[model samples]
Target: MQFMEDLKHLLDISYPIIQAPMLGVTTPAMVAAVANAGGLGCLPLGGLSPEKSLALVKETKAKTSKPFAVNLFAHSLTSEVSEEDIKIMENYLEALHKKYNLPFEHKPISSYRFYNHHDQIDILLDEQVPIVSFTFGLPEAQILSQLRERGVKAIGTATSIKEAALLDKAGMDAIVVQGIEAGGHRGSFIDKEPLPQVGLISLVPQVVDTVSVPVIAAGGIFDHRTIKAVFTLGAAGAQLGSYFLAAEESAASEVYKERVLSSTDTSTELTQAFTGKWARGIGNSFMEEMKNSGLVIPYYTYQNSLTAALRDFGKSGGIADIISLWAGQSASQSKSGSTEALFNKLIQQIKSDTNPIF
Candidate 1:
């Protein structure tokens, strides 16, 4: 278990388990709870303004003195959205809005502008977050350098061995091998027609073999068995997100949590219908209807902004079908309750094994 020991030492946590930094779902309380319970807690700051990211960091620190990580979206925030593209998507969304009896309007170009991660990096450095991880792609070399100069550990997400090798060469302390079964957005940064489709079992060992940095397996990993399976696959640790969607501290609405808890392996599918990026979520009427409409979805941030109001309406009205219910393939195995209880149960389950990895 040298890999496990090395990972724990590197993260300064008692366990190698990392609570995935699930944006829109993870809260300061959940981060603190995981950090306090002997695992690495990650506050997802991807898509948030610098001010809000800093506030959440401060709030998490107020709850726990333990080390935790923060994540950022390293993808390009800006894209040229042609008027034709905008009109096409708007027209499609307008129909959905009318069906829902919701207000529909045009969004200006500035509405899609997101606060870049470079600005957010200043907050991380200021707060002295122990670890920083990014998804979608690697950050600028200078950003990674600044983090290292500050003695902060950096982790990167990769869906293929090529991406993992790039991050390792870039001096990342760790790499999350995000398998295809992972929930949320596909972390495939390389420009290709089809995304990488490796499963966790196939991905972890390859990334582990390809990268010099510690490999953390992510994707459809839910319980103690899956955690152990990843370790056996040569992963130093496991990064789990969907497993926590039902945690009491999660920001997911009641309806969303209910959907996650009730869903089976077959309930979810990968689609670009919502955010214009390939993300796995429980399939619903919105995704189905949008697919049937045949309007090409815009790129992330653009399509994300266009659908923001409808998602807000769905969330506020406790409507399950409209909101994106992001979850891993094994989401049915997820447990419900407080994070502390969930962690304790997971720990107990692992220890119950006659020869435990941790």
Candidate 2:
């Protein structure tokens, strides 16, 4: 009860459900809809420029007066791309381009030096965003301090107890414990050869116990059943991304939405083919081909830039085989409708249940 009260007070929201910030897929309308529905909607600025982030924050504010959050990719960037690996991927992508009759370009990759969060923070402070969240890793200490002084609450993502403890020590208002079942990029900041494979069932309570900050459960949580399950495990809240993938406000294309709707329990797999970082998504030709090629996958930013064209082509053409169709294991249970309708339905389901957890 204290956990729920503290989280709701800290976020200034009626409910503790967070609409996970699926960068590129999250739009202002979707975020606003969730916030208007009493949940915290998140505008994801993971790879967007500061100018773009500013515009989006303004747009979301215009749409809703309720509290919401902005998410950023705080991963430490490196310009240490392997030439041999890049060339190999180039060759592979070139072949795929020709096969698909798509245009190919060997543009120079940008340095990681220009990808820091300094500019984004300035925009957030200027806009006075109510909340901010980070993925990949935590933001710098100075940035966190500035956010605190300005009355902006910060949430951090962690895939293990170690990361949760670190975020708790770093003064995170709340920490989202992302299980392996989470779709999209793994929020792993630690240098583990193999990422942690803990499921939501096993990871939630451990991180809840490890952190003094409120623990928000993420991954594989869809409906009221899962929400109540997580609360029973001591989570103050649950963050759902894949559950909203099919919402009408979602930025996912028709094909992408359809893929999420049809996904089965065994339909998803963890692959880095799309972003050069491990992520869960529906299996596709691109993932399989890249996994079978034996070519060393380049790290993020580089690998993401290299494959952008093909993904764009696939998206424009409505060809689902080549594009990234990120979804959780429970995607098959998703509902396709307006974000407000879906969000309200979840809340109603929770409140009306005989043993309500909210």
| Per-residue alpha-carbon lDDT of candidate 2 for residues 163-225, written as tens digits (9 for 90 to 100) | 889899999999999998888888988865468778988999998888898999999999999
lDDT of 1 by residue, 219-314 (tens): 998888999999999999899999999999999999999999899989999999889889999999899988998888888878888899999999
Candidate 2: which pairs clash?
none
Off by over 4 Å in 2: 110-114
Off by over 4 Å in 1: none
> All candidates' TM-scores?
0.98, 0.97
Model 2 collision count: 0
Cα displacement (Å) at residue 234, model 1: 0.5
lDDT of 1: 0.89
RMSD of 2: 1.3
RMSD to true structure for each model, in Å: 1.1, 1.3
